[model samples]
Target: MSVVIEQPKSPRSRKAANWEKYGWMYMRASGAILLILIFGHLYVNLFVGQGIKGIDFAFVAGKWANPFWKVWDGLMLWLALIHGTNGMRTIANDYAERPMVRKVLNYTLWIVCAALIILGTLVITTFDPCIDPNASTYLPGVCAVK
Candidate 1:
């Protein structure tokens, strides 16, 4: 008795899209940025002033008041989301065996990731802590308009 194993074709031979190369580059770029953004976020949130104890609704409102922190948070949000999403895509490609299953899972993954990213970015950028504070339980007393 004998058995045979078929090897996958080279990407060049199959003329597959260059998505892998782009994906590799994205990983490296996102990883370096993630390191900076992650550390900076931690430094401010855990080391500034009263440290973690200072984190409250007021603290967040103050932070968002500054354009700098807004951009910082926005960058962190985009970078982390793209990095995580790409990583998950790699995992899905590796684990999903059936063509149909892989396609379905990847489609779902991208749709959900995109939706969350858009919604989160919108919320962060447009957030107004002082908007009808009395109407919302999430608002702090300090944010109520006098």
Candidate 2:
């Protein structure tokens, strides 16, 4: 006797948005971009400077003073946070047997991610290299008087 297997999922409707597909695509795109951003960040901070010994508050202040670095770091922060949260969401969907638990977990994950991204972006944008009390010690060029 011949047997026929039924289709697992119904065809998607044109009106409905495919969030899973979008999320999957986002993971791939963000992951590739994150690799470049992360590696470049490491190369600049570690190799271009005095290596590990050269990293300090002053180094961070100097880096944040530049708009380019601020934007780069912001991008890295936002992308990484979202990518990680999406990954966690996927895991929850896969492993969590209860629907309510999965929903709660995903909601909590996204909320935390949103909070961190907002705070991190604010830090990057509002960072004042010259805000140090010991200006000469932390950022000699910008905060110290000549």
What TM-score would each prediction reach against the true structure?
A: 0.79, 0.86
Which residue pairs in candidate 2 have backbone atoms (N, alpha carbon, C) closer than 3 angstroms, thus clashing?
Answer: none
Q: Over the stretch 1-146, how does candidate 1's per-residue lDDT look in tens digits?
A: 22221223325336555676667778899899889989989999999899999998778887887899888888888888888888887887777777778778888888988898899899888988777636345544436444
Stretch of 10 with least lDDT, candidate 1? 1-10
**What tens digits encode model 2's per-residue C-alpha lDDT throughout 6-109?**
22244555987667777778999999999999999999988995987899878888787778998899999999999999999887877887777877998999
Clashing pairs in 1: none
Whole-model lDDT, candidate 2? 0.82
Compare the candidates by lDDT and give the number of the best one.
2
After superposition, candidate 2 runs with Cα above 4 Å error: 1-12, 144-146
RMSD (Cα, Å) of model 2: 5.5
Each candidate's clash count: 0, 0
RMSD of each: 5.5, 5.5
